[model samples]
Every structure is written in structure tokens, then in C-alpha cells.
Target chain A: MESLLERYRNLVVLLAILVAQIVGLAVQVRRTSAGVNTLDSSDASGVRLIRLWANTVVSPPERLIHSGFGLFAGAWTNYIDLRHVRAQNRDLKQTVDRLRLEEAALLEDARQGQRLEALLGFQEKYIYTTVAAQVYGTSGSDRSHVFYIDKGARDGLKPDMAVITPDGIVGKVRDVFSHTAQVLAVNDTSSGAGVILESTRIRGILRGDVSGRLEVVGILADERIHPGEKVLTAGGDLIFPRGLPVGVVEKVVRDPDRDAFIDVMVRPAAHLERLDEVLVITSTEPRFSPQQQQDLSVSAAEEESVPAAVKDQMKASEIMAEKLPGLIDPNLAPDQQPLHDSSNPNPVVQPPQPLHPDRFSPGSAPDDVPEPDAGSPPDAQPRKPSALPSANGGSTLPGSNSTPEATPQRNL
Target chain B: MALLGADLRRDLEIHRYPLLVYTLVPLTALVLQAWLPRVVGRYDWFDLPLVITIYFALGRRSPIQGTLMGAAMGLFEDALSHNAIGINGIAKTVVGFLAASVGIRIDVENTTVRILLTLGLSLFSSALYLFVNRFLLDLATEWSWLTELLRAVGNALIAVVLFPLLDRLQSRD
Candidate 1:
């Protein structure tokens, strides 16, 4: 047995090594499948630490080399860029002047839009906080569609926060380390976001295929979806706020497996391949803007007095109600009139406040009437509920049918 | 003339590589593999580490040495990647053993043979990786035979150019 082992020792060692590695791989697969899943927020911690150590060792030299190249490129471009400086500056100045004028006009329109949005209870999502980070490297293999950013947990970055550029939404922070974070680009197969068709408002879930192409699912085949429609975030996922530009639809086809849903391909707005710099959103606040707040306050104040346009409509209704007979309550004290629409057969009476007897006494004259200022809320006692018409075409108040005309004269 | 038949076991010309070349070559390949996609843009088929593993394995002409070298190189490559550690290690170990076993019997010194050998080994490694990833670990992978062939062609093309330069670093037996 010992002689046979010595003869085939090389083969034996090779088999032993391969088997050991295979066993180790099996152990990892079991651990990964058991309960440690990246989607479940329990990262493959064992592998992550190994990766972190590897990155820490490898990144410094990479950054050094990158910076060296960047410096050289910057210098070369600066020299070449100086050739047309004077002419370019003059043209840029003229363009800036034109843009300033256009901006003034647009600002007014934006302010008006804000007022309207305030009235509709729309809350504008603003980037409350952000951390700018340089995209140092990518996840090398195409199978793992993620990139590493220089910013990390120390930079206040957390998983699921939206990472964006000026162009559009890029992706979200997937894993955070002490000095580096992994951004799973939206084109990664594992990543998904809630998105909507900008034109038709048809919402769907956007996901990436294994080929790194983007597609949206869950839009019905019959929906009026077309190519080139802009895609925006629906914000239902809460990671990306609503209405952030996601991409544009590239193609639409009927889903083969499911007839009810259509497969829509999207061309991402941000260039996913050539990403260099990105902003990691540390915090976002979806709230009313200052202008919106003021507009909302004005709307609340106006609610009490009612708009002039609304008041005119109310006066027309009141005058029409007065022509109907036996609607006014004659015997009811002047102070006891319903405060709201009594002219309507079914009046929605607001809860009435108690009235003193002296206010309704016959001796009280016009001089004694309390006048409300233009800015003040309408007095609660104003215009006692006009007499409501009863089911039998009579007033509900006692003696209202007997002396309806007398009641109007006294109210006037 | 060198491709003519020679005794497989007795006439094998085994060579050694300098310790510096052994250490620095793999480190350089690992670093370049990790960083090149950033500079030259992404090409998934351009695996620098696999080429280094094949070069070292065939040069040593010993199955045990080749297996250990392949395992170490693969583990470090895995460390640099987002993938789990043992996937590449197992694949490279198999490649190393096969390449060394084949190296003992064949004239691998010819440039044409080296290129073809590199291409075949790369495809074999890639297949093993996919099998282990898909069946063993249940990891989702998208495979295209056309892409795999193109990748093999790319790696072979790289081997054609790289092997001559690396031949200078081989230590004399």
C-alpha cells in the first residue's frame, strides 16, 4: 500500500486538494442558503470581511494610479482648452444673459405652480442631505453588477438610500462598509424600483435582466403604453421619491408567459456604464416648501371667510331660496335662525352657538348689529339658518306658514 | 521538430520560475484584473488571473505544485471579487491539475500549442465555474455559448502575445 501511494502521490495530492476545496465550497453554499441572504439584510459577513480586506489592500494603489492619470489629462485639456477662450467666453456671456431672462419668466410660473400644488396638498420632495463620493471602481465581473464608492458608513451612507447624479437616478446603496459602500446599479438583476410611465401614469416595477438591461413589469397589455415615454419613480418603494426621472421606455412587447402584462424595456437616463461621480443621499425630506407653506396658510385663512367668487355663488343660492314661499320661520326668534343653508329642503346645519335673548329683542336696531371686518372670519351669528322647507311644502318653525312674509320683513 | 513524439514521462523538460516572478506575476495579474475594467472599460472575458494560473501550472509540470498554485491564485482572485471564495478556487484547482498532467505528456512549449491550450483551459474553467455556481450554489447566471467562445478566443489572443514575454521570466531547471 505504501509503495502504491508513493508511485501515485502527485495524483493523490491533486485529488485531495480539489476535494477539500469542493467541500469548502459546499459549506459556503449551505451557509449562504441557510439563512444568510443579501436581500434579507444579513450580508454574507464572512465573505464581506474577506472582500473588505482585499479592497482595502488593493484600492490605495488603484486610486494613486487613477489620480496620476487624471492629473495628466487635466493638464492636457487645460492647455488645449485655452485656444478659443476669448471667443467662447463672449458667446457664453450672451447665452447666460438670454438664460437669465428666461429664468425670470420661469420663476414666476414656478411660484404659481407652487401655489396650486399647495392647494392640492402636494408635498415637494427635496434633497435634505447628501454626501458626494467618487466612484473608485466597479465589481470587475459582469455577473455582479455593483460598483464601489469611496464614501461609506463613516460618511453617513446607509443601505437603500438613493444614489443619483445630475442626469438621473443611478441606483441605491446596497452595502455599507467603514470607508467604502457598494452601489447596486439599477441595471443589476437583483435591484428593483417602483416606476411609472410619465405620460399615461401607468405604474410598474422596474427590474434588470441578467443581461444588464432594464425592464418594467406589471403594466397591462391593453394600457396605452408606447416607446419613448419617460419613466419616473412612483416612490411606493420609499427609497426613491416620486417623480424622479428614471429612464425612457425603449421597446414594448406582449409578455409571452402572462397575457395580461406587457414587457417594456427602458433605456436608463444615467449612463450606467461610464459612471464616475455620484451623490449618495444621506437623507431626504418630502415636505411643503416655504412658498407652499405660505400659500397653504393663506388658503386656510380664506376658508373661514370664503372666496369672493364662492360668496357670490352662495348669495345667488340664498336669493333663489327666498323666492320659494313658506320657507322662513316667523315665530322663531331672529337669533334662533339656522346659521347655514336653511333655504335648501335638507339643510346641513352646523352646530349652533347659544344666543342671548337680548340680541333678538325687538328693541335692538341696525346700529346695534355687529359688523365683521373684511379680513375677519364671518360671524357665527350672521344670517340665521334660512328657514328650511318642510316635506309638506311648509316651514318647520311654528307659525312659519301662517306669517312667512312677516318673518322676512323682520329679518331684513 | 519539437512537436515530434518524445517519451511523455522520461523526456519531459520541467522548468522552475524565480520566487519573485512567482509572487509578483500573480499579484500583478490580480491587481490588473481588478483595475483594468476601470481604465480600458469592461470586458468580462479578459481574465488575467486564469492566464497566469495556466502559465505557472504548465511550467512546473508537477500536478501537486500546479494544484496548490492554482488554489492560492484563485483564492486571492476570489478575495478581490464579489463572489464567494471557493468557487474560483475549485475551478482553478481542476484546471491546474489537468494542465500539469497534460503538460507532462505534450509539447506545450510551442507558441501555437500554448495558445490553444490556454483557450481550452479557460473555457473548461469557465464551464466548471458556471456548473458550480448554478448547480452547487444555485446562483443565477446568464450563459451564452457564443459569448463563451468569443471569450475563449479573446483569452487565446491574449495568451499568444503574453506567453512570449512571460517566457523570459521562467527560471532555468
Candidate 2:
């Protein structure tokens, strides 16, 4: 038996190695299968030790090389590339000027929208805090489309956090280590997110195909999807926030596997192949714009200050104004309009007071009277008041010191 | 205990390298494999670890050593990647054993033979990888014969340039 073992030792060793590996593979496959049901759970915990070792072995050199390249690139851009600076600056200045106007218009529109949203009591998820990470390496296999970022758990990164660029979303954090994290690109076959077509409002699952292309599935074949329509995150996956740009529809074709479904190919907005820097969303909060929040607070305060009966009266008046436009003369100023109470036969007319009674010295002008403007037309001048009969049958000017015994009413 | 016949063993010329070459070459290959693609974009056609595995396995001319070397390289490659640890291990171990077996009988020092061998082994490894991923693991893998062919050709071309540079690392003693 020993002699036979010696003779076939090499073959036996090969078989043993292969069998061991096959078993390991099977174990991993089983674990992965189990983990798939819990979509947000970390996968392959058994391999974490190996992954950690590998990362420890590989990360330093990669960081060093990346820094070296960055230094050179920084020098090139900051010092060596001065020839285009003046022209670039000029163009940037022009862009800033144009953007300033556009921003003003957009700010106003956003405020108006936010005010309306506050009125409707709508809440939305917004990106609250993000950590900037530099992409220094990848998984190094074409089959696995993942990137390693410089920031990780130490930098407040966590698994399943969304990674994005200014252009659009890139992917999500798959695994987080102390100093580095793995980002599964959206184009990875295992990666998926809930997405919606911007124009058509059609939602579907965005998945990466075998060839690392983004494809939207689960849309009906009859849906009128056109190329160049925008795609955005639906936020149902709980990984990416809703309404972040995903990509644009590149093409729509009938799915060969599913007769009822059509596959929509997407051109990713973020350049997944050539990513350098990414932002990992660490936390999100439901929020409104600052102006909207202020408006909401003011509205709440106003509602709190007014009594319910007064509110009802104001609402009734608004309804009445809407129904009878002729009730209040549109031409007359608000204070100049006659106040008529339907229950009372006689209405009291309040005279318009002086614009600046404080400006006049004592006895220089009547406190309740407005001085006539010299430049105004004769018709625009304040008319002198005729003496009215008092309760005692004594004639007295309306502004005179003698007080009326009862609330004075004007005969129409 | 000898797996090969004495006559066959007599014909084989074993090549040796400094210990640093053995350690650093594979390490460098793994590092560069992970790093270069990020700087140069996703040029997945070339694989440095596979090239290093094939090159060393061919030169060593010992089935046992070659198999062990391949397994180590493959495992490290898998470790560096997001793949299961043993997937590349199995494929590369087979490549290593085959390359060494073929090395003993043929003049693998010949440039044409080296290119052909590298090309053939690359395709074999890719096929094994696909089989494992699709059938055993039930993973979705994009398979294209044309792309595989191009990748093999690309590895062969890279081997042509790399093998000669690596030859200088051999210990004359």
C-alpha cells in the first residue's frame, strides 16, 4: 500500500487539492444562496479573513502608487497646465454669470415647489451627509466589477451605502473594512437597483447583464420606451435615494427569455469604467429646503395665533369675495372701502388718517386729517368736512374735541 | 516516489530563481493586476497573474512544484478578486501541472512554443472558470468565444515580452 501510494503521490495530491477546493466552493455557493434571500445582508463571512489578508497585502502599495500618481497629476494641472488657464478662467466666469441667473430662477421655482409640498405635507428622502472617497483599485477580475475606495468603516462607511459621482450613481458599498471598502459597480451582474424611466414614469428593476451592461427589466413589452429617456433611482431598494440620476435609456429590445417583458439597455451616467472619486452617502434625512422650513414654521405660528372662529370667519370672507367680486369695489384701496354689516341698517364710515401724523407739530394739523398734496389734482385733495349734528343737536366738525354720546353712523 | 520515468527526468533541465524572485514576482503581479486596470481603465484582456503562473510553471518543469505554484497564484488571485477562493485555484493548478508536464517533453524555451502554450492554457483556464461559475456555482457568466480568443492572444503577446525579462531573474548557480 505504501509503495502504491508513493508511485501515485503526485496524482493523489492533485485529486486531494481539487476535492478540497470543490468542497470550499460548494460551501460558499450554499452560503451565497442563503444570503440572497436577505438582500441587504453581508455575503460570504467565511471568506472575510482571506479577503482581509488580501486587502492588507495589497492596499498599501496601491495607496502609495495612487498618491504618487495624484502628486504628478496635481503638479501637471496646477503648474504645467497654465497655458489654458486664462481661457478656461474666462469661460468659467461666463458660465458662472449664466449659472447665477439660472440659479436665481431655479431658486424661486424650488421655493414655490417646496411651499406647495409643505402645504400638502409631503416628505422626501434627501442626501444628508456624504464621505468623499478616492477609488484606488478594483477586484482585478473582469467577472467581478467592483472597486476599492480609500475610505471605509473608519471613515463612517457601511455596507449597502450608496456611492455616487457628480454625474450620477456608480454603485453601493458591498463590504467595509477599517481603511477601505469595496464598491460593487452597478454594471456588476449581481448588482441591482430599483429604477424608473423619467419621462414615461415606468418603473423597473435595473440590473447588470453578463457583459457588464446596465439593463432595465420587468417593463411590459408594450410600454412606449424610447432612447434618451432619463432613468432615476426609485429608492425602493433602500440603498440609493429616490430621484438620483441612474442613466439614460440607450435602447429597448424585446427580451428573448420573457415574452411579456422587454429589456431596456441603459447608458450609465457615471463613468463606471473610469471612476476616480466617489461619494458614499453615510446618512440621509427627510428634509425640506431652508426656505420651506421657515415658511412651514411661520404658517404653523400663524395657525396657532388665530382662533378657530376667526379662521372660519376669514375663510368665509375669502369665499364670499370669490363669489361676489362687486361686493368690494376693486378700484378702491382696502382701507378706503366701505365696511357694511348686513345685520345693521346704518354703516359707520371710518375716515382715512394722515400718512404721517407724527411729522406734524401739535395743532399744526388735525391728528386724524391728511394734509393735501400741493402737486395733486383738485379732485384728489381732501375735502373740508361739513359740520354734523351731534346727539345734543349741536353742530360740530367730525375732528372737533366734542365727543359723540353714541357711536356715530353716517347716513348714506 | 518519482512520478516521471528516469529517462524522462534525465532530459528535463530544472531552472531555479532567487527566493526574492519567487516571492516578489507573484506579489508584484497580483498588485499590478489589481492596480493597473484602475489607472488604465478596464482593460480586462490582459491578466498578469495568469502570465506569471504560466511562465514559472513552464520553466520549473516539475509537476509537483508547478501544481503548488499554480495553486498559490490562483488562490491569491481569487483572494484579491471578489471570486470564491478556490475557483481560480483549481483552474491554475491544472494549468500548472499541464505546463510542467508539457515542459519536460518539449523545448518550451522556444518563443513560438511558449506563446502557443500560454495561449492554450489561458483559454483552458477561462473555460474551467466559466464551467465552475455557471454549472457548479450557478452564477451568471458572460461567455464569448471571440472575446476569449482575443484575451488568449493578448496573454500570449504579453508573455512574449514578459518571459524574456523574467529569464534574467534566473539564478545561474
Retained true contacts (fraction), each candidate: 0.50, 0.53
The candidate that achieves the highest DockQ relative to the unseen native structure: 2
Clash pairs of candidate 2?
Answer: none
lDDT of 2 at B78: 82
Residue-wise lDDT of candidate 1 within A1-412, one digit each (tens)? Answer: 9999999998888788878777766555543545542221323676678768777766777677678778977877897667798899999999999999999889967965654454233122443466777789999999888999999999999999998765678899999999999999998888999998765567899888889999998888844677878899998998987878889999998888898889899999988897776777787753567888898899888776887889888788667545431333433444553434346777786655446633334444333444444465443334534366778884444343444553454444
- The TM-score obtained by model 1 is 0.39
lDDT of each: 0.76, 0.80
Residues B1-173 of candidate 2: C-alpha lDDT, one tens digit per residue? 12456346535556789999999898888888888888878567877888888888788887787888888888888877776788899988888888877777777777998899999999998998888777777776778988888889989999999999999999976
TM-score to true structure, per model: 0.39, 0.40
Q: Which stretches of candidate 1 lie over 4 Å from their true place?
A: A31-49, A71-412, B1-12
Q: How much does each candidate deviate at the interface, measured as C-alpha RMSD after superposition?
A: 3.4, 3.2
Give per-residue CA lDDT, model 2, range A246-323, as digits (tens): 999999999999998999999999889988767888887645678778999999998989999999998898677645
Give the clashing pairs for model 1.
Answer: A337-A385, A338-A384, A338-A385, A339-A385
DockQ of each: 0.24, 0.25
In model 2, the runs with Cα more than 4 Å from the true position are A31-41, A71-412, B1-12
